[model samples]
Target: MMRTLFDAELNKLNVDLTKMGHLVEVSIENMIDAFKHQDKTLAKEIMDNDRLINDMERAIESRSFNLILRQQPIASDLRNVTSALKIVTDLERIGDQAADIAEIILNFEGEHAYRTVEHIPTMAKKAKMMVHEAIDAFIKKDLSTAQMVIKMDDEIDSLFQEVKQEVTEILKENSERIDYCIDFLMIAKYLERVGDHAVNICEWLEFNQTGTMNDHRLI
Candidate 1:
């Protein structure tokens, strides 16, 4: 009877984590759209919805800790609950960074303010893909998918380097648009960070599976 009850509670925890992941994914998508269109209205909406992500994190955290205290989960079960706690922290940060990007979009000026940086959209898409895959890996408990997401971060980093080079050329041609270029650089940096957070989530998934992180055993 106790085992069944614990499994049911664990399943609910997974459900909540999946729900939070979906929310973060949508925020990233909306942020990309807002940036492409310079839609301050949609940007504001993303920012407003960020609070929902924050609340979800808190709720998940509480549930995870409660599971630990009430159930005294052992070995893999303990890792599962603990990893959910860590994963939610990363998810919350991804939500914040997405909101940060939206805030940047809200600050753009002029009627034709949206600059067409060649690599930003591509970088954003890749980063969003990493986040989506990381969440999917968690849902499926697939280590290969998690490892692939980690490998994808290198592409995101390489694209960020290309954006930096492009930005330098833009500045050389016209220093007057320095502010715009700086904002663009920041957006690229945030996307890179998003890739990083996805990698972190994957690493935690690895830890959950292998009983170690970065080859250091915690269990």
Candidate 2:
């Protein structure tokens, strides 16, 4: 029956999307190390592996399109396909943000990290964990866990604000150190954005079940 075929295709899409999410999580992990050590080798590796994320995006996109076209899926099924497309966009953007951080890492000449870098690694780790949990929620279709990840984004944003406040003080005390401090701010911002993307993943996951929430507090 058509229903059986649709369900089979749907399961396969979850598998592919989960695989893509795992790669994005690892890329973010490597980026954290790349920033922490200011390792050009690690930074270069992040850049090199970006194409793999690109390829994964393409693969998931193809699968999503096939499902939509062949299944003529509507209601929750349509939402799933649409959600997969949105998830890919978020994942690709996460990859881009990670690469951008890596490019900045290369400029440090593998020097000691910028003054506020102690927090960047911590923030990256938190954001990466949120992404991991969000992906797990998607795989399990666990709305409660997805909601928890959404709540955690609040903490990540707060941490980002704390880092920014500290960096502002440093820049005021030593204006000459502004260049490196700006890099630190960017790392903080990217991790914050990563948290936001995780929220997006949660948002779409929920949309299929309870319909869309008008409030995007993650914004």
Quote each prediction's TM-score.
Answer: 0.95, 0.90
Native-to-model Cα distance after best TM-score fit, residue 118 in candidate 2, in Å: 3.9
Residue clash pairs of candidate 2: none
- Residue 91 lDDT, candidate 2, scale 0-100: 86
lDDT of 1 by residue, 129-178 (tens): 99999999988989999999999999999999999999999899999989
Task: Please give, for residues 1-219, the per-residue lDDT of candidate 2 as tens digits.
Answer: 999999998889888888888888888889878776667898898888778899989998998899888877767788888888988888888887888889888888534774454566678889989988888888888999998999999899889888988888888898998897888888888889989999988888887665575454221
**What overall lDDT goes with each candidate model?**
0.92, 0.83
Which candidate should be chosen as best, given TM-score against the real structure? Answer: 1
Candidate No. with top lDDT: 1
Our model 1 lands, by Cα RMSD against the true structure, at: 1.3
Model 1, residue pairs in steric clash: none
